[model samples]
Target: MNGFNWRTLSADELEAQYNPRKSVPDFEQHFTAWVERSASARTRLPGAYDLRYGPGPLQTYDLHKPEGSATGRPLVVLIHGGYWRGLDKNTMTFTAEPFVAAGAVVVNLNYDLCPAVTLDAIVRQMQDALVHIVAKAADWGTSAARLHVIGHSAGAHLAAMMAAAPWAGDLGARPQIASLGLISGVFELEPVLHISPNQEIRLDSAMAVRNSVTRFAPKLAGPVLVAVGDDEPQAWQAQSVDFHQACRDAGTQAHLMRVANANHFNILYALADASKPLCTALLRQCGLK
Candidate 1:
């Protein structure tokens, strides 16, 4: 199934492959836990909430600083995954705990969902958020020179897009990104267009091709950790495998991790646990381990 072209698959097959919730019967349980944990994190962590990076109502983020002074610490940005249609920064706040304890400034970002805005618009919103974070890094007690991005699912797609962004040519400056942690990402957007969520995402072929990270070379001079749950559908896992290969082929340092006994939703827990391989790899990338 990994070698089969997604274009040759039937719509039903594609949906079965791409729709993660279909495979995880207790998906709601994960969401419930995340919300509860995030609330607890917000109460315990020292940070500013609802900081706006853009004019949109959803363009806000929560910044959690490390214990004591955050001066010269690495900035870790987290993007939540809701298939570009659901979820927000709030469900992701719990992910900041491990990084914050490791002495990194962590940010949980939010952006406008689909149907209300195009996927391209969401991508631009993420780029804007990165620009804002980089510009305000010093004031926040971090440095853009040691920036690390970690995203899950659709957010991972956005992080890959950021890595491939033409910052110097388009934004007039290049951000010094240290590493990218792309977990359970969809690098090939074409299959997404065939999935049920596309009704709201409204991703046409051109837009899908335009946004597919595998279609372009990454503009990064750092390592990329592309990980997926081994228990995930073969087609879904192939996305990470192929994207990691793409990054390596483009002369970027890339590593692929097949997490055992995990699924799409549960894999995020590994990211929140510093002792886990996924979290440790990211910490090492940020020079924290």
Candidate 2:
């Protein structure tokens, strides 16, 4: 190792040393551990309605209705981020509480995982769930126009894709999403493929671009806050920054912010307390604060 500066190693070599191939989000591990630790937490929220897609275990979402919340209240739909697999709706239970406290009905969604299916298929399944939610929103005490989406990591990418998806070509009805709150979001596919060598990443070249929020700006009804934790790897922050600038330049309402003293795993935790800057920022962006 003569003259081999450790810091000057190539990206691939760096990743090989830093990002182990087995290091995925581990949602299953987290979710199971959570259930075991917290015995009384129900599978779904009280009064939350369920609609199944295929033969798979009818995917569930926990809907939290704000006190005094009625049919016209704003709705924030949250998709959990566990790379592309690993997590379920339970981790997001805490995520729904604050928005509910903020007078918005909150829905934490779940879906099928990869290795069980491809990314494209999972996206479609999510879309179908959203379509059903949008249609039956009235029953859930909200409507599409009252809709907003907040996704972290993989969930953030999916939320952005929904904004860009071909509505007339597929669902016939356009989703009335009023705001987007992307936490630790990945907007570019090249980075996911080239950057962090994490096990949660497994996208083909085309899908990477196709699903990247930066590569495609969906028609957003209002401003979207792309936030990243300050302590994250440079590449993670860069992804959100590039997309935020692109959205703002395109005349779509967008801005980038830094979550102080936070990291990837717990960014959503900050979103749970109304007084926290990230939570405050999210509400301001949603026109709720």
Candidate 3:
């Protein structure tokens, strides 16, 4: 399937390949688990909540701290995925628990959804949020120089964009990103234009091309992990495989991990477990393991 164009697929085919809900029949159960676990995490974890990084109403983040002093610890930012239109940062706080327990400061970021704002605006919001987080790293008990990011689905796409962003102008200096955990991300936006979610995302061809991460050479110096669930469709899995290749072609170190016995929604369960391979790799990347 190398060099295969998703554009050639029929509308129904694109929908089947890209729409995760279609593949996961019990998707709502996963969301229920995430919300419940996230709530539990919020009650048990010690850190700040609803901290605003921008003027937008949803431009807020929850910072979960490690058990002990966080001085010099790596800061891990978590971005949730809801096809860029659903899901909230609150439901993603569960992902912060294992990272924080592993001695990394974790941040769960929230941004305005599509239709209310363009995909480009959401990307910019993530960049601004990172800048704000990096600027306030000292106050958060973490260093800006040891930042790492992990995002799921659309959030993964945004995380890649952040790694590729030129941060010198925004933060006055480029922050050293230790690693990127991109799980089930769609690096190319062209397929998104065909997906049903495009009704809300409103992505034009030009905008899609402009926002596609695969089209750009990686600017990040750190290693990247492109992960996907083994149960996902061939086209869906190909997204990560192709992006991993793109990163390697750009001379950036990248690894591809095909998660076993998992699908799109449930893959995050692996990410929330410290013992799981996905979480273990991310913790190791943060220098906590």
- Residue 150 miss distance in model 2 (angstroms): 0.4
Across 247-279, the per-residue lDDT of candidate 3 in tens digits comes to 898899999999999899999999989989998
In model 2, how many backbone clashes occur? Answer: 3
- Cα lDDT for residue 33, candidate 3: 92
Worst 10 residues of 3 by lDDT: 165-174
How many pairs in model 3 have backbone atoms within 3 A of each other, for residues 3 or more apart or on separate chains, i.e. clashes?
Answer: 0
Tens-digit per-residue lDDT, 1-289, candidate 1: 2375787888888988999988898999999999999999888899998999999879999888977754889999999999999999888888889889889999889999998999889988888889899999998889899999999999999999888954545654656678999999988888898889899899999999889888785857889999999999889999998888888888999999998888999999999899899888888988888
Error of 2 at 33 (Å): 9.2
- Residue 189 in candidate 2 has what lDDT? 61
lDDT of 2 by residue, 1-289 (tens): 1222335557775554233222224434545554443233343334364435334563667667765646677878888877666677666666666676667777778887765766777777677777877877787677678788999877887888777755545766666678888898766665455546334556678877667667567657587888988866565566777778777766788878899886676566687678899889887766578
Predicted model with the maximum TM-score: 1
Off by over 4 Å in 2: 1-58, 194-201
TM-score of predicted model 1? 0.96
Candidate 2: pairs in clash: 27-86, 27-87, 28-86
Two-way TM-score contest, 2 vs 3, winner = 3
For candidate 1, give the lDDT of residue 189. Answer: 89
Worst 10 residues of 2 by lDDT: 16-25
